[model samples]
Target: MTTSSLLSGADGAVELRGPLASRLLEKSPAMKRLLVYLWEHRAEELNEYAIATEALDRRSDFDPRTDAAVRVQVARLRQKLKEFYDDEGTLDPWRLSIPLGSYQLQAEPVTKDGAPPDLAIQDNPPAAAAIPTIAPQPVVAKPPASRYLWFSAAGLAILAMGWLLGSRWERQVQMSTASSSAVVVSPFWANLLKGGRPTQIVFPNPVFFTWVDKNGDTLLVRDPAVNSYHDLERSPSLSGLEAQRGKPILAQDYTVASDTRAVFRLAQYLQPLGTKISPSSSTELSPESADSANLILLGTVGTLAPYQAYLDKLHFRIPEHKQYIEDATPSLKAPVHFETVRESPTRIVAPGIVALLPGHSSDSFVLVLAGYHTNALISYLTSVNGLADLQKARTSHGNPEFFDAVVLSEVNGTTPLRSWVAAFKPLAKETR
Candidate 1:
């Protein structure tokens, strides 16, 4: 039988004989779950966390410990498959194996004449006594030409069918691959504002925030409290704050659209006094002495109380930031106006900004936080954006659960950040 013919039929149970069948029987439950998931979602691209979480039965239950365990199981499963095929020898008619980094099942057929030794069994037994004999019978001969014609026709039909099916399968695979690449290569700003879970880090005192992206690229953003600004008077280099200015710090090649000049100015303003400004300062900062002088000075003009009041006044303008605060908005019972609640410990809300970066023709997002409760804010942000489950995974695992961890800053708060964080509680859990 030809390889194409092997794919025919709804059940296709016979086609799965040999190594594939043996592997299925021998695989562990976790390995089986992983395989089944890959088979079901073959048309869709999945990440490691998503695969592991699904296999574990609870997407929110992932941790480093669990992740390590799953990796070990998959390794063992791969080894077992290799040993099974090697022992069965080339006689096995089918190939069964999992490709690395991808949880996919690949199968192909071998010629029937190549059937494994274990599969060849005979029913007739040889006579114990040599005295038993039988007469030979005349054999009928078949035309070789007719047999060749039949085989050729079958081969042609299989080829035509394979071409049609294979073309469609190739298109599906291309589309899936393109979609996955787009998601993976998306810019940092895009992922931060609108993609995965959103994390807010509030700063009690100005501290430099730093974190690494998947590509090992470093991102540095100073809090409003940093007390120093970028000194535009100094020469620029590809390192430090100068390299970051103007150039879109691409995450996956996506750029932030917010005024690169403003970002440069912000970075400069955060630089401490006596710090030399970059030579590229002319490209980003105004040359006026007043502007240059004003650029480098940084100090806390007011406390959290006043800052919270200022934010409440502009609440309507900042939708993303306001949505987060409103969801976790604390209750107030008094003759106090919303602004009055700003300075009080109970009323002090952190100030945050969500800036959209433009790349090509689309917008990506970047968020900056100023005030107390950075961790709590990040937890809250992730929770509200349907990414709380990812946060849970990271908290349990001791590392981030997604592609990026833009920045994190420690700050004190009375309650667990999770307590104030709000999840997108669905009105109905099921559609039916």
Candidate 2:
């Protein structure tokens, strides 16, 4: 049969015959004809020109000038046939093939049992058989400027709300800090005065002190004139100590004089006790002397039998007291390269006395006696360095609730430690 006639017949019966003819036709009419030509003249050899001419039909309109386009069409159609058979006709009873330089078609039996050849043709019919259907979907378009405007408005609203909330929070925080500051009494001087002491004592704005007693007990001596002292015998004991009526002695009698010369002398005595001396001139401590001095100071502070018992109760060691100075020394001295080490050693000479006398809430004042050089001690006490270290320690030790507020003041450089008591004289007059 002519190639055209065989292709027409195959097209009509493609669904019943197999996927070969249907797939070839789906690609292009020229390719379908080429396939048919190959099938019909399978025993005949053919060249490219003959295949192209047959693909374009036997008409003058099928010019030699268009033979290249026709060949390309045929090649594309063959590829489509290959893809169809690979995807859906892999198990078909008939196999199709095309050899180069030849136009022919051949069918090979793919199934066993020697079934009738026509059975394959009857199995697939062209019409009335379902083919995969793909429905075209409509494309969607969006409005431009209005969408962006809505997004911008939402972003601005979020930013404005955040700014307002942040401002309000900041204001509230500032107010809270100011209020807490008024009531925040520092613990630096808590050990300097007795907790229950009723003495009329004055303290400077800033002070540091600790209790010398091992029990951490503060002595509360009553002022005979105050009504609170009248019931001292009936009142609760002072830090658990009995209250005895006696004239309060001046602080100078019990401690060193609070003057520069006194401080120098005290610092001198303390030199063997780890007290760092900043002399007017450059001087270096021998390594052995430095070690010996530090050892003595640490041993004396750590083993102060009275305070040791109390500190032990709190799990605090005297080494901890000097930790800040020791840790900060390297950083502090890095810039100055000061060979003569400047140090401030602080020790509490007395426990603070807090008296609940018959007066208003504001009538109370705390006594503090912090021992340090007028120069080095002032800088250490006023700076946030020590306070920050204490805060970090509290956190690391898992004692988040611990808070200490200290008032620190410098001793007069001109007077002795004894004469320095005048500076605190004014605190006794504070109204309740």
Candidate 3:
């Protein structure tokens, strides 16, 4: 609230200005957004999703299930912040740092009552607030006046995000909706939000497939949910099949009815919270979206196939076509993977993974729900009174902030006869 503080870089905390802002201007657009966002919204809870939705122009459609864009960019922003302070900001009196996985950028005065004696908050600013046209005067390293300019620079950084970040895509994206459901205030939910704030629910975008016939021959085709069958153009297997029997591939809109039902079921529990449970998928999941809010992700190995990178990050992972959970790192001799015998690989007891990890920011979280086949997830959520069961499952361990679960979905023709939590293991906080 201090205003009228004469800006300076040395002997105490100073208002941000010319030098600080100039240095930030040299960083990437994402970095600039991170810095400015922290400066303005420092007092509020922040995470990757908030940065993506609010800072990165990701709208309501944004998803974080399959995308790690927010994680990558935030890591880069941290590096740049270090570079700024180590170089141009070395002598600056204030120490500013955005804690890893958090949006709170804290500012501390080098001395007690470091703000200038003249500084005071007022409804109106004095003429000195707009000091302009001062000639660039040469100063040796660590000059006292340098503090003043640096404070000005910090102010400029805040101004830049408010004006510049918004102008870039103000028309393309809308602010987060206010109508989402009320936030759930529970020990389990609190672990996800870490601050009793809203969280996002992300679904998976499965890759679709089709079989097409041209003349007397049938051809296998891969569809990318697009208007064209462009991927089949380079298929060596298809080319070989064509040589034996003439045929062509066609495009079709892939639809899985059961998968749709699973999504609807997921929404039943999540959307009730309204805006607190913003819905998105890997296809549309922006890096920042998952960072900002606690996330609930749903899919199977087939549907979640696109998120292998994220799958690798999970402590309990069920790889596509693999019948076991890949957690050998903890104990190679231990048989962690459980499989059920069946006629078809697609129809066997599918493996579902439910995991919770530190979200993009330390204050947020990501919850992953998936199975081997798409139906495995659908059956579990729709049949076992999912909404209630999920809550029970989460609290079973006394509201753990991080855990990896191995889930089994026993199916009787797309209906989960019963579901079980085969194994549970606590995972270390995400260091990577």
lDDT of 1 by residue, 1-432 (tens): 322233232123343444334544343555544544444443233334455666646467675333555556656666766676677535665555654533444443444655431122112211111112222111101113211111122222222222232223333333334223322221222343342221211112222223345564444332222222342222222224444444323111111111112222222221222222331111122223222121211112211222332233221122311212222232354211111023333223332222111111122221333222332333333222224443553455353212212112111122211222111111111111
How much does candidate 2 score in TM-score? 0.21
TM-score of 3: 0.44
Candidates sorted by TM-score, best first: 3, 1, 2
User: Which segments of candidate 2 are over 4 A away from where they belong?
Assistant: 1-16, 20-24, 58-66, 111-432
The CA lDDT of each predicted structure is 0.30, 0.29, 0.47
Per-residue lDDT of 192 in model 2: 18
Q: Candidate 1, overall lDDT?
A: 0.30
* Strongest candidate by lDDT: 3
Rank by lDDT (best first): 3, 1, 2
lDDT of 2 by residue, 62-175 (tens): 543334564465456556656655766666665554422223343444546333233344354321122122221110011132111111222222222222322233333332
